[model samples]
Target: MSSSAAGRPDDPVAALAELTEAQRQQAMRRWRLLRPHLEDGVAITRLAAATDASPRTLHRWLTAYRNDGLAGLARRPRADKGRRHFPADLRLLIEGLALREPRASIATVARQAAAVARDQGWPIPSYATVYDIVRRIDPAMATLALDGEKRYRDVFDLVHRRQAERPNQIWQADHTQLDLWVITPAGRPARPWLTVIQDDHSRAIAGYAVNLGAPTALTTALTLRQAIWRKSDPGWHVCGIPEIFHVDHGSDFTSLHLEQVMADLRIRPVFSLPGRPRGRGKVERIFGTVNQMCLSQLPGYAPRGTRDRAGRAQLTLAELDTAIGTFIRTIYNHSPHGETGVPPQQRWESASFIPRMPDSLEQLDLLLLTIAKPRKIHPDGIHFQGLRYLDPILAAYVGDSVVIRYDPRDMAEIRIFHTGHFLCRAICPDLANHTISLKDITAARNARRRDLRAQLRDRASVVDRLIEAHQVPDPMPLPPPAAPAEAPPVRRLKRYREE
Candidate 1:
């Protein structure tokens, strides 16, 4: 028969075009198996013996190839390709068992199905057939049935990902404990927390803070301030007030102080749902990327479960901070984003849109720089957290209830406000020349208090012993004379018992 009439092809490419993808793959596989016999004249029996196929199958394939071309070697679609012969009820039962909570093993499901089939006098399916039925169930349905709604939502639920059209239209903030350990100022190894502010549109990191303490409202505020203000580094240019500040449902993010700052800046705060963190996935991805690309290369890279990770610590917090800043400016911001196909810094600058900024750094600081605490001005100064803050202006406001705002990073100085008006910046004379953090001051105060309490306990025990000594009368001195008289009488007259 001619090639066209026999549905065969003299050209391999033309033959492939006429067949579906599966058919084409099958034809290629068969061609590979028959090549030695057809081209090298190897015996058919030898080829069959070497391969998984038998001689009869080899002969059929060879004959078909000779009659037609490569097309004849392609497997034809079966009439019952997807249709199963089992009863509808049996299929449902198998699926139900497979999808039960605490999902049974495939073998267990097959055994149970076989037992049920035997009891019902229905056609029992082989294990492979049972497995195929279980596999055919929709994965989403199976996940919901076997796992739970939460797992199903996390894995299979369709998400409406949030995206910003402009660079400053949306910003996301989040905190993660870095994988690397760094030495604190006090020479202790600690895993630092990293708070990051990022532009949603460009995926550019605007500002970040590395601190030994857990993320607090002050940390978030400081990071936000850094993000909104222009950077001193010429290479890093991402800054400005965002239209929408997106964050998770963390207490720091939900603080009234943060809310007030957002209101003053005309930025709307968008919080993710209480238990749903998917909304913050964009910012969260940056943490993993940083851990893998930046931190994993650094000294003391303590990924979870590493023993003696602290012993490997070599870099101080400041050094680590500088390293992270360098990485962001030199590498991360410059690298092309996998999703955007453009470097973050380049994308952010491409729009040429001027960001909305505070009128002045002072104005921004007034809102985002410090945590506010209500303090009454004493005769000496303002007392807060066991530290005395002094200012000449405070002399006039003595005994007055005023508000003092201080940077947790520097407890040496604080800004005093009276009835919401800016007052003088007060300083602690005791903490002058050297910077002392709020945490340091607190730790010192606690240590001192503990020491005083220990002394008091010792003194209290001594006083109790003295009081008992003074209150008790001296032991009566009468017993010695009576004992001597009885011994003398017994020696003189042993027989006079009455005397």
Candidate 2:
């Protein structure tokens, strides 16, 4: 290499950029602090304020650099170097205090050490010296002593960023507890949970579930269901069975139901090592965006510490669900992502390759909702939790026990399985027309009570108005004649969810 090109002092920054991050950080810290002196003839007072170091210390570093090139800018070692020597007790005290369970500040330890030194008639170490000693201690030692092994690994662990070459090759699923609190079904303020499945290639949120409860295998399965099935909205076309399901080491991801479903579909499940979630960075990044972009604007956004009135809870879980749906579709999916530099929706749809999919939506529903229950088929119908389901196919299975699967949110129908084979979908006579949840029924009852009380209030006003108009009420007037009644006509209702 030529003399001019051999990492000359004039281009130290250019040379520094070529080094690794750790080495660059150490070198840059010294270079930045000393740059003002080398380039501009700046004042000591200005340099002190800029670097937060004493003038004497700045001069010392400048002298060191001029004498020994870039290497001299580093801190000078003691005669014992890494080992403890003169004022050994003080050095030990500072490092011990730094690595204590509940860490002590340099100033605090310096003051305490001064007190002990006075009693022992020994020299008291300055705060700066103590600070330098603590700062130089091995980072691994500090992490292990203060935050433990888990944190040490979290901070210093080696990670490989992995992604699929194309969409549907691999998918990532994970859950995050949102920062905003929403009103639960029980009418209490609670944080809602979110489960999202993303394409490893495009970083698109293929499917998501927002609920005010702990994440379960059901939620993940349902999310996977949405991801695999074609969407009604044409804009959202990211559908297909994924070749690989990548997820963290969560119980919800490792459930037997998920295993069975994946096995049946031939989709492999890849779990990140337990307590080391480095591979989940892509999903984690999405969650961070949600916290910053979506939750921050929400009504009940709870940030760290001093929970003031600004974070007052307002939206219910249902309302939040609608909000989340709108945000995901309109904003998040359409916006250009930081990593991919393209809108996730556009990226997902840009490809022409067909994704592998299930034969039918029914087959998907049967596999995903694994809440199967064994029930006996009676002559009248199949009996379930307080509801009787009827279907012509059940007539043949009368007096026989069959397994049934249902969605708790809707008890309008249940899928029946005879001897591990799908028989037919049986409908509940009363709730056949509309999907009904137990919570909805409870809410309806409350609403009905409210309406009756409102009617009573209206009647009271009517009585008061009549009394004011006629003090001597001319004995209540005769009721009007009844209208003619015709024979009630019989009409068949529309079949629910007709195929």
RMSD of every candidate to native, in Å, equals 22.0, 26.6
lDDT of 1 by residue, 349-428 (tens): 99998889999998899655565778898765787778888765565566799887877778788888898899888888
Worst window of 10 by summed lDDT in candidate 2: 1-10
At residue 358, give the lDDT of candidate 2: 89
Evaluated against the true structure, the overall lDDT of model 1 is: 0.86
Model 1: which ten-residue window has the lowest total lDDT? 1-10
How many clashing pairs per prediction, in order?
Answer: 0, 0
Model 1 TM-score relative to the real fold: 0.72
For the record, the alpha-carbon RMSD of candidate 2 to the native fold, in angstroms, is 26.6
TM-score per candidate, chains pooled? 0.72, 0.67
Name the runs in model 2 displaced over 4 angstroms.
Answer: 1-93, 111-124, 304-312, 430-499
Report the number of the highest-lDDT candidate: 1
lDDT of each: 0.86, 0.79
Tally clashes: model 2: 0
Q: After superposition, how far is residue 60 of candidate 2 from its true place, in Å?
A: 19
